[model samples]
Target: MVPAAVLALASLLPVQSSAAQNHAQPDQPAKALARSILQQLIEINTTDSAGSVSATSKAMEQRLLDGGFAKEDIFLGGPTDRKQNLVVRYRGTGQKKPVLFLCHEDVVEARREDWTTDPFRLIEKDGYFYGRGTQDMKDNDAILVTAFLLLKKEGYRPDRDLILALTADEEGGSSNGVDWLLKTHRSLIGDPAFVINPDGGGVDLQNGRAISVDMDATEKLYADFQLRTTNPGGHSSLPVPDNAIYHLADALERLQHYTFPAELNAVTRAYFEKLSTIEHGQRAEDIRAILKPSPDALAIARLSAVSPEWNSILHTTCVATRLLAGHANNALPQTAQANVNCRILPGHSREETRQALIRIVADAAVSVRYVDDAGNVHDTAPESKGFPPPPLTPEVIAPLEKLAATMWPGAPVIPTMATGASDSVYTEALGMPSYGISGIALETNDVRAHGKDERLPVSSYYRGLQFYYEYVKMLSGGQ
Candidate 1:
């Protein structure tokens, strides 16, 4: 729950629309270009298996080269030859530091058998664009590329250098695109004012109407813990009381009843404060109550139980994602393991959660260990004591609020912390403040990112294109 004093910083004023006046509606040619780039990206198999990120990187590199970008300003390489990243610089007048527009080109694997339509092909049906990367992020990749091309064609020079990075392996792989870039090619992406990641923030829609524009300033840390219990093997016909499978089951049951204490930070505090105004009935009341100096504990509990998203936002969440038992069904289980995936609260340490899990399990025989392929236990970010999240500076917030008001009047712009992780963590760790401000809006209930039949609304796609085009211009001092 949030504190009432935090609401004092909330600003509901609309920003003057000077950039909007300067920008014109996206014409047919621009629309066609955006669609073409999006379709090309979606059709290229960028999945982990049976797909090569190098192919997509090469294609995008060619597009920039053909668009009059200097060969030196463009870079396409990665730790591995197969997993490549593309970094392009749109030089400005050097009046201010560079601003990075970052997005991942790799997408979650989508099988043909799992989707009703070809997941790799961009298809427009029922007022929606159905595809794998439509929502999880090729949409933003296309929009950013389209904006870059349009800006170049129109001769709209920015006040500062604008860097566009389309990286690989955000979904899951040994060669993470952003990590590789930071380690190998840090100079390619210069020190920036801040990063605007379209992968994070968006408008939340309900009943086809805009509710709020969520601007993600921070995200939870992702960590996986392996819980294992081992015992001597025996024949199944002579079952023993001290069985590995039974001990593992007991630990899991205890974990199911355990819940981390609800914690709040600046981003989450402001989130609940603004959301309280829009939500109705008891939920709204509970939200408001939680913001008070003396918050109602019962109300917090009630709200936490209502939705999984709500629970995650309020607390550090751990759930068993995978399980393994005996080698053979006929033999007593010699070993059992469970993969407990946890999305830790920002500024919290993975070791703290690991300790908590061990304490909760309360079994000396059960071993809890952080699972990392590299075996580097120190890879997790150290925990900070208080709410040490990145601030929502006026430079970033003003434009976003103004744009949200311009696009969907009356909708409040709220800063949020993502329960899921993103590549932004890498940049933030490198001392550049990163934000998720993707202009694409989606229905909150129907978000199919990383799921089967992922899609985005047709109207939303075009709106996002226009929003980003103007927003980038504004950020670059166009008005």
Candidate 2:
């Protein structure tokens, strides 16, 4: 399913000359290769409509093959045709278990009309790379590929094999890339010591300077519940108190007033402990108070109400996203439905969240039920419970902390819990400790991962390249 234009572009890519390959300083060549790969990926329109992940995977597959990788070490298949994943292994001496590098090839849909320039085209302007996946990812994918190829060229042997999985549909669609790979091709990844995912972690910056390298060791659980109310249809003039839309509205109002209790885990505790040092005044005081064995109730309420992000990190959150009611303009609706999305904390059960919703609504006419990933409605609880947050073991954090000091100098490496979800959830669920360390730095106010005009600073992109290059080398025992 590779697009003809992408393949044509791939065929036209300039080959690295012998002189450039032989140069003692390989940083230039590696950066060029990374840029080339990133541009090609961005231009392919890998959205669900105009582009194919299979195409992107094949393009990267060809790059590795051209760099002298054996065909057998590279895998290009997924559950579906257009949604194929690419897994490449760079074999080592087998002194240790393999290390996995994961990045999704799929991106959120972007329309040409919504962007200042073409979303599918990589435009370098104002010292930034403007595109949909530039900041969300694709930058990490390019860096990983470039590093692998450069290391191969250098003949740097590792104590363990390094596996790279460029996957599809991590941005909300059918057939998640990581889920499919885990269920179908677990052996390809093998039982690695842990996984390095660049999807969740990032360097938080202020005024173009890094404050800290945030490593997300855990993520909130994503679950959806459908709130529905049914009533007999009636004429507009004969509206009754038992209207479905009104019942649903009242339930949602009650939910808006409800808030989950504040709690803290190891990751959040560390996050606040570090964050408190940088903040001042009441905000800093509130952060420190929350870290106490018994947090101040007033401080928790003040902090939670002041910021939605703080609220999400402190407690599970459920909010109505989509609503549907009347079939006709002039008729009382026979049914009303609302989709309530919840980001539950680790160890929380889907059943527990659903039951809480039922209690909050407290309406016999309003029924709450779980909605499966495929949009199927089910009255029963999920068969599987939410996975607990992974422990921040020394094996993962030590190298990260050491490298963060070397790379950014004085920027504290903070353990974080992602309010958003990532493919790491699937790997962690399979008992493989997964950590999100995208190795890219982003200003806190400048994140546009799924939004329009998404971009990454030109300098930050290269910094990420160097960061991951060394980090991967150290972890893989090439240093």
Candidate 3:
């Protein structure tokens, strides 16, 4: 669905860019600049537990300053001194409204003992860059920074103003950067036509070959439920079947076995429609059958059996993530609790999912309650669904399609829903559509973000650098 406006914007002439630097070729300095920026960011600890996000924000601010951006165009502020967000405006000819680009500065906590190499240090070995944020993000941060600097240095003018926001607390915390900026510094990032987020979607590769260039159109809502039961304690030797542990365990088992009904929205349907064209044989047949007025039950079963992703896309998933039961090994558990995390499909509220879980457990003794990020327990969950997805306008989709075809020849661009969540939740709630457009490619099996030995392919980082360079230009009306 290419917007008619995109085709018309190309005919406009390029005026003198506001903050043009020294004349330099776009391609020559991009690779080196990207690597340096990524290395600096990776080594800096921006984790919520033992790092300062504002440190990285300042470092990045220095990079833009050196690239000749006016100091007035850049602003740094957040909820706290330790967690600051960086927002920079790349001035254009003002032919159109601004476009906001968002990425987070925080990475999940990584321990040295868990990773083979230092998680904070960028170690390039065996064709990969191993670091905490390599896959989860920082790589895209480098890509975006490099693109802005390169474009600025090359004097490339755009038709619309471009806003770049590298913020903090996206991983998890009370001081969320996106929510804060939109609340406190509204003018810093004015209402953009739409947003481009590098947090979720990109090229999905299998066995070193590109499979699908996924554009995350929407994502599932994230919610956590606390399942608990309490009973009178007894000695281990006198354990009873009606104990707290048994009741809680039984409830969790029921939830594990129960599957939510199959659901699909326009984005997911379009995802499979485009994917079916790229697949072959029985896999292809199964995908096509799922699109019929009455999707074949056998087809859903087959696809769900082979791919966890397809299964998640077809259904809302809730699983026990953590459990705490019993005070000591020698005593019967007096209280037992398990945490159930659910990724609800769009069009469903948190309260609706909580009610569904209560029904699935079907035990009056076991209580289901919503848990907030700050660990507060509530009697009920929110009755609101995730912000509705906006239309897939042409101005956004067309440029990515054109660039993706050129970069990854066979990888077709398909709009897929993110099974997980990102900070785009805040902006999307404001009615500005956000599309996940990370040009970084990753193998299906090698995704290690927030886990041990998180890494990104060596070549993938460089390709991402080029992707944003051309992509930002194309969408902003650059020649």
Candidate 4:
């Protein structure tokens, strides 16, 4: 027998009738519009060093205006002349609060030399869309823009408002668009029923087969630390044992050999448990062994060695991302510095990680300092843990399940945490429940968001486009 409270909660959520379950997927016009928007966005450089995200925002705002949205409903503003954010709202019947669809327009810096094709140009060859933001997500930006336009064309009003926010500097910068908006213009974004972010979460595919539809229920904390050592310079012919470069290099070598202890929270523990059921043979056994109270050392080592994804899930990871030294070749370096980037697990604090790094380095000569987003260096960091993950309410999960059943029949929807991070950090920080759910599917081996030759399969892009349209309709109680 079900409890009375459980039944009451179930009755509050809107149920999808058989008639409401189906809708036209991405038709020809929708595909063309999405493709055009994506190409335009790609060709316009939004990189941190040289690109103008402010211009990109204005261009999108014009598109919305041309599509019949009033000039008053669209907003464009940010901290600076080059970095701007766009917020557009679609009116509704006022039955519920708005749903915020947050996507960042800025992408990681891409160079022409690093990729086979120009990273700035949208090239479709061999069944894939090759571009910088194709995978790390201009695709979702285009998808959401197209969905709103199509809805307006159909004259379909929903039970609640739908808001889309395209912003700057999610990849890397001081003036984060989401942070600026929340601080300066919370009234525009307004209160939301919830936030659906497409910056993370994806369909996991292995060997071209659907493994699971993963949702980023939570994410690791991002922190960067600077390691520095200084000493008196000397001529290359007169070398000394006490050298800055040697000290810094030795500390980094120790860091390379060491790994953080295995730590798992509620989300990751459940992730491994669900993953064990899908994975088979020796791999499955290793996962099960690691879940034990005293997990086997060999199993942890073997699994962590083979997959970086599993390694990140199981432990806090820190690696040296940038290094600088040697002002002159003829003289000993007076100073040396390196940037150690870390993704800390949820329970640990940034300060705690810094303290651990100091211990691992075991050298007083090499000083560790915390580096903030603004490039400010400090000796200490905050003791607070990462944002607590919100409960997976039925209202959020039900629609996802219903849609996934029709699209990928055998795939299970699994809740997992992001190994890296996204702009969801800004919204979730405000106590607004944010979830990362994108319909795009990519192969596990071909995962290359920030790497060379970043591409999304042509079929996958269109399918994801269709999925977001149907998904928003299902969430908003639209026909």
Estimated TM-score for each candidate: 0.91, 0.90, 0.91, 0.93
Residue range 1-479, candidate 3, lDDT tens digits: 11110111222213323222111223545777888999999999999888999999999999999999999999998889889999999999988889999999999999899889999999999999999899889999988998899899989989999999999988887788999999999988887999999997887665555656778899999999999999889889997889998889889989989989887789888877866765667988998999988999889889877777788888899999899988999998889999999999999999999999999999998999999766789999989897667789999999999887767755667787888989898999888999988888787666788889999998888878878888898888854
lDDT of 4 by residue, 395-452 (tens): 7889998888777655667788888888888888888888899988787668788899
The alpha-carbon RMSD values of the candidates against the true structure, listed in the order shown, are 4.5, 8.4, 7.1, 6.6
On a 0 to 100 scale, what is the lDDT of residue 324 in model 3?
93
Candidate 2: Cα lDDT at 181: 85
Which 10 consecutive residues of model 1 have the lowest summed lDDT? 1-10
* Model 1 error, position 300 (Å): 1.2
- Between prediction 3 and prediction 4, which has the larger TM-score? 4
Descending-lDDT candidate ranking: 4, 3, 1, 2
**What are the runs in model 4 whose C-alpha is more than 4 Å off?**
1-25
Candidate 2 C-alpha lDDT tens digits along 1-479: 00110111222224434442232333677778889999998887777655689999999999999998999999999877889999999999898899998999989889889999888889999999999899878998888998898888888888899999999888776778888888888899889999989987877765555566778788888888999999888899987888899999999999999999888887777767766766668977987888888899999998777766778888999999999998999999999999999998887888889999999999999999998766788996665665666777786788888887766655667777888888998898889888889678777777888899999988788878888778877887753
Ranking by TM-score: 4, 3, 1, 2
Clashes of 4: 0
Q: Which segments of model 2 are wrong by more than 4 Å? A: 1-26, 49-51
lDDT of each: 0.83, 0.82, 0.84, 0.85
> Which segments of model 1 are wrong by more than 4 Å?
1-25, 277-281, 373-387
Task: State model 3's lDDT.
Answer: 0.84
